[model samples]
Target chain A: MHPRLTLALTLIEAVAILAYAISGFIEARKRRLDAVGTFLVGFATAFGGGTVRDVLLEHRPFYWVEHQTYVIVLFVASLFAPFVLRTLSRLFSERALLVADAIGLGLFSISGTSIALEAGMPAFTATLMGVATGVFGGLIRDVLCNVVPLILRDSRPYATCAFAGCWLYLLLDHFDVDSVYSLIIATAFILIARLVTFKLNVRLPH
Target chain B: MHPRLTLALTLIEAVAILAYAISGFIEARKRRLDAVGTFLVGFATAFGGGTVRDVLLEHRPFYWVEHQTYVIVLFVASLFAPFVLRTLSRLFSERALLVADAIGLGLFSISGTSIALEAGMPAFTATLMGVATGVFGGLIRDVLCNVVPLILRDSRPYATCAFAGCWLYLLLDHFDVDSVYSLIIATAFILIARLVTFKLNVRLPH
Candidate 1:
C-alpha cells in the first residue's frame, strides 16, 4: 500500500473511532453510568468491532492493543465525557453524526472484508465478516446498554449497505481494479448508499 | 497432562456446554425465535465464553472450530430443541439446571485462568479473564435475547465464585501444586461456592 493511502485510511479510522466513542459516551450518559462505566462502554464501542474481527480471523495484537494512543485518548475523553459530549453535541448536529457514522460503517466494512479475504476466508464468509466489523461495535454498545441492537431492530439499511459495499469491493478486486481505488470506491458506495437510504427512510420489509 | 485427567476435563466441558445450550434453547423458545435463530443462540451460548477467551488470549482455531463434533451436536439438537427441551425440562428439575451451570462456571473459569497464565498474562488480568470466560456466554445469550446480562443486573454470586476460584487456582499453581489437583481443587471450590451461595440466597450489597 502507498504511504498516502495508508495515511488516509488511518485518518479515516480515527474519525470512525471517534464517532463510535461519542455514541458510547452519549449512551452511557443516558444510562447515568459512572465515569468508569462510561470509559469501559466508550472503549468497547470504539474497539469492539475490530476486536471481534481480529478474533474471528485469529489475528493477534488487537487493533486497540496495537494502538495504545487510541486507548489513551478514549480514556481521557471518557473521564470528561459528560462535559465534553455536551459541548460536542452543541457543535455537531445530528446530521454530522449521521455522516460520520456512515463513513465509519463504510470504511470499517471494506477494511474488514479486505483483511478477511487476505486471510483466505471464503468470499461469502468474508462479506459477513465485513458486515460484522461494520456493525458489531454498535451491537456491543447496545448490548451493554441493555437495548436491542439497532441493526437488528431498526428497519434501516445499515448493515445492508455494508453488505452491498463488500460485494462491490470483492467484485472490483476480482476485475483487477487498483487496490487503493477499489477501497475508496467501495467505501464511498456504502457511505452514499447509507445516507441516501437514511434520507429516504428506506426500510426492510417486516 | 495425563490422559485420564484430560478425559475427565473433556467430559466436564461437554456437560457444561450442554447446560449452556439448554439455557439458550429455553431463552430462544421464550422469545419465539425461528429455528435458525434458535440454533444461532444455542451455538453462541455453548461457545461464546470459550471463543471470547481464545480471542482475548490470541488463541487460534476457536474451540467450536476445532471441535466440529460439538458444533454438529449443537446444530442437530437445536433442530429439535422445542420438543427435546420440553421433555428434558420435565425430566430435570430447576435444581438440575443450577447444578449444571455451576459446574460449567467452575470448569470454564479455571480453564480460562490457566490458559491466560500460560499465555503470560498478569495474575489480575488472568483472574478477570477467568471471570469473563465463566460469565460471557450467558452475557451473550442475554444480549441476543435483548435483555440486560444476568451477571450485570443480578446481585447473585455467579461471577464472584469464578473470581475467587481463579485466585485459588493461581495460588495453588504458585505453590507448585500438581496441575491436575490444582484444576480439580479450584473447580470444586467454584462449584461448591456457587451452589452454596445460591442455596443461601447470597446477594451482593446493592
Candidate 2:
C-alpha cells in the first residue's frame, strides 16, 4: 500500500473508533447497563467488525490486539463515558449520533474493503465484507440491547451506502486509480450518500 | 487429536449443529420471519459460535465452509422448516427444546475447548472460549429475535453449565486422562447439569 494511503487509513480509523465507541456508550446508557456492561458494549462496538473480518481473512491477533494503545484508549474512554455522557446530555442531540454513524460507516467500510482486497477476496465478497464491517458493530450492540437490528429493520440506506462505496473503490482500483485517491473518494461518497439519504428521507421499502 | 477422539467430535458436531439449527428454526417461526430470515437465523445459530472461535484462533476455511454438506443440510432444512414446524407443533414441546439445547451446549463446549487447546491457548482462555462457543449460538439467535440473551439475564444455569463443564474437561485433561474419556465425561456432566437445573427450577439470583 502507498504510504499516504496508510496514513489516511490510520487517521480515519482513529475517528471511526472514537465515533463507534461513543455510539456504543450512548446505547449502553439508554439500555441502563452498568459500567461493566457499558465498557463491554463500547469495546464490542469499536472492534467487533474488524475482528470478524480479520478472523475471516485468517488474519491473526486481530487489529485491536496488535494495537494495544487502541484497547487502552477505549478502556479509558469507557471508564469516563458515564460522566462525559451526563455532561453532554444537555447539548447532545440525534444529529451527533447521525453524523458519527455516517463517518464511521464510511471509514470502516473503506478499511474493510481494503483488507479483504489485500486478502485476495473477489470483488463481490470484498464489498459484502466491507458493508458487514461497517454495520455489524451496531448489529452486535442492538442485539445486546435486545432490539431488532436497525440495519435489518430500518428502511434507511445504511448498508447500501457502504456497499455502493465499496463498489466505487473496487471500480477505481480496477481502473488503476491511486490507492489514496480511491480511499478518499470512496469514503467521501459513502459519507455524502448517508447524509443525503437522511436529508431526503430516502428509504428502502420495508 | 486421536482418531477416536476425532470421530467422536465429528459425531457430536453433527448433533450439535442439527440441534442448534432446530432451535433457531423454532425461534424464527415464533417471530414470524420469512423464509430468508428463517434461513439466516438458523444458519447463524448453527455456525456463529464456531465461526467466531475459528476466526479467533486463526483457523482458515471455517468448518462449515470446509464441509459444504453442513451448509447444504442447513439450507435444505431451513427450506422445510416452516412446514416441518407447523406439523411438529403438536409433537415438539418445550421438553424437546430443552433437551436439544442441553446436548448442543455439552458437545459444543467440549469441542471448542479441544480446538482452543490445539491452538495452544492458555487454559483459562480455552475454557472461556469453550463456554462462549457453547452459548453464543443461542445468544445470536435471541438477539435476532429481539430478546435478551438467556445467558445474560434469564438467571438460569445456562452459561454456568457450559463454564463448569469446560473446567471439568480442562481438569481431566490436566490429569492426563484419555481424550475420549475426558470428552465424554465433561459433555455428560454439562448435559445432566443443564437438565437438572431446569427440572429443579434452579436459578441464580438476579
Q: Whose lDDT is greatest here?
A: 1
| Cα TM-score per model | 0.61, 0.60
| Share of the reference A-B contacts seen in candidate 1 | 0.20
By TM-score, the best candidate is 1
Best by DockQ: 2
- Model 1 lDDT per residue over A1-206, tens place: 88987898889888888998888888877776655556657877878898889988988766775577787788678768777898988999999988988988998899999999999999999999999998999898888889877889899999999999999999999999998899999999999999999999999986
RMSD of each: 6.9, 6.9
CAPRI grade of model 1: incorrect
For model 2, the local distance difference test gives 0.82
Tens-digit lDDT track for model 1 on B146-180? Answer: 87566654666788789899999999999999988
Off by over 4 Å in 2: A1-11, A86-93, B1-43, B49-58, B63-139, B147-206
Q: Any residue pairs clashing in model 2, and if so which?
A: none
Q: Which ten residues in a row have the lowest lDDT in candidate 1 chain B?
A: B147-156
